[model samples]
Target: MSWTVDEVMTRQVVTVRPATPYKELVALMSRHAIGALPVVDLVDSDGRLVGMVSGTDLLAKERAAAGARRASRARAEQAKAHAETAGELMTSPVVTARAGDALARAARIMHRARVRHLPVVDATGRLVGILSRGDLLKPYLRSDESIRHEVATEVLGRLMDLPPDAVEVSVDEGLVTLRGELETSSAGDVAVRLASAVEGVVGVRNRLGYRLDASDPRMPPLPGARGLPAAEWGR
Candidate 1:
């Protein structure tokens, strides 16, 4: 069964307001060791999430804003005076999650959208919890031997079209290593790609030998090639 996002979401989410000062925002994020802060504003007497302030966004603006202030005494004092509010720099139309979303799906969304914090909300849109990639990685980072083996086997299954008895999957600690002759170089890539996709497969050592064929079906790693449509390993 797919894992639910809320099952793994970080419950203690740090947030800030739109009107919060830049220095204050930075201090809060730094204190909590967080990359993003949800921007909360009032709506009908209830706190609502209007946007989010992220470390990346703050840095992007700070480089330009800070330079202008350093050039003159007046501007230096004005850094606080005219500092842009979260309303100005924050990303709006927040990307949110439900209590039951699959963790894999949430990771995919986070990856594709380039987001770090995903707030979890109930059906009524009230906030419940938050999720981050770091939180998602924690469990897998601490798994034991049997758990690691099962996970490694699952990852290898996704990566290659293994001949029924050709390849072996083994996981020691958090390492997922693929063993066996791949019959081609591209299969090595397949193994790497698949192993990396799983949540907790930390280090991947490709001991599997790859096969090559210029004229046959087995593929070479052409710069833009993907493991799509199945690259034949030996035949």
Candidate 2:
């Protein structure tokens, strides 16, 4: 089972309104020990998310006040430097993640948006929670036994449709080792790939043996050989 953002996100989020003063924003972040704050519009009953303000955003004011001038500063940065309120300092068009979104998908969104924090929103675009880079690392804290169970029961048994004893899964410090005998090399490869994708799995060691080399076109398909075609295996 894949994890969702809501599962790992901090449900109790610290947010600020657009009208929140810069001093208040700084105080709030300091009190919460958070790097950023989601800016919401309280006028709407739902308090819909409007933007985001981070420590970097607050630093802009200090940089300008200190007379730090750089030609490389973008126009948006220049504007934020003189901004006094969250409405003016915040980065509009905030990047967000849905509660039900997959953690991997949310991570990709953060990467593409170049953001470290994401405000988790509901279908109505109301802020429900907040996700940070640290939250994504929570899965890696799963017990080794838990990781092994998932690989055996979820990956090999259900996903690969293999019997309970068909594959032997072992884990140590998040590294997974698979020992099994399958009908074809494609099946072994699929097993390895699926096991590697399991949460908390650091790596997969493929010790699986196959009766047929179906993946190699040069090898003739043996009589009574039953395995996924090479082209189909790519899926």
Candidate 3:
């Protein structure tokens, strides 16, 4: 089964108003044990995410207050140093994730944006939840039996239309080993790839044998041609 942000994200999120005081923001973050807070604006009873206030943003003020006159500091840092409220110190045009976003996609967004936290929004852009790097790791906690079941039932039985005995799925500590014979090399390759894509799968060991090498152009096509196109198989 595919996991989405809504499944793993924290539904109850602690947010700060744009006018929230800087000291109060720190207190809230400390109490909640969170490194960042979503700066929001209440519009028509909806908490619209406006920006983000992170530990790095708060540190800028501390560094400036300490009289560190480093010329390398950006003008933006200098400005944040003098700010006294969340709106003045927050980073705007924030990167966000949708509630329906896939967990893998949300992980990519977090990695590319270099942020640990993501504010989840609804279709209308209202804050609904929050995701963190810790939440992305929840999938890894799935039992080995569950991963094996999905690889067997979902990937082999349903997607590939393979019979119950067509593929022998074994899982140990999230590692899947597929051992069986298929009609063609393309089918075997697709099976391996699909098994690897299953949630909670650490890796896939492809021990599947095939009757025909569809990838070999010289080989004659099978009667029904269950193999995928060359271009698709290559992928």
Instruction: Give the best candidate by lDDT.
Output: 3
Report the Cα lDDT for residue 210, model 2: 82
Candidate 3 ranges with C-alpha deviation above 4 Å:
1-3, 69-73, 103-105, 139-141, 163-170, 177-190, 203-235
Ranking 1 against 2 by TM-score, winner: 2
State residue 87's C-alpha deviation in candidate 1, in Å.
2.2
- TM-score per candidate: 0.54, 0.74, 0.73
For each candidate, what is the lDDT? Answer: 0.69, 0.87, 0.88
Candidate order (lDDT): 3, 2, 1
Could you give candidate 2's per-residue lDDT for residues 1-235 as a string of tens digits?
8899988999998889999999999999998899999999998668999999999888887887787766765677778777989999998898899999999999999999888999999988899999999999989888899999999998888877889998899999999998978887767877888888888888999888887676678988754344445454554
Segments of candidate 2 deviating more than 4 angstroms: 1-3, 72-74, 139-141, 165-168, 177-193, 204-235
Question: Model 2: which ten-residue window has the lowest total lDDT?
Answer: 223-232
Q: How close is candidate 1 to the true structure, as a TM-score?
A: 0.54
TM-score of 2: 0.74
Candidate 2: residue 87 lDDT (0-100): 93
Clashes of 2: 0
Write candidate 3's Cα lDDT for 1-235 as tens digits. Answer: 7899998999888999899999999999999999899998985567788999999889888988887656765787889888999999999999999999999899999999999999999987888999999999888788999898889899999988899998899999999999989877777878888989888898999898887776688987654455465554564
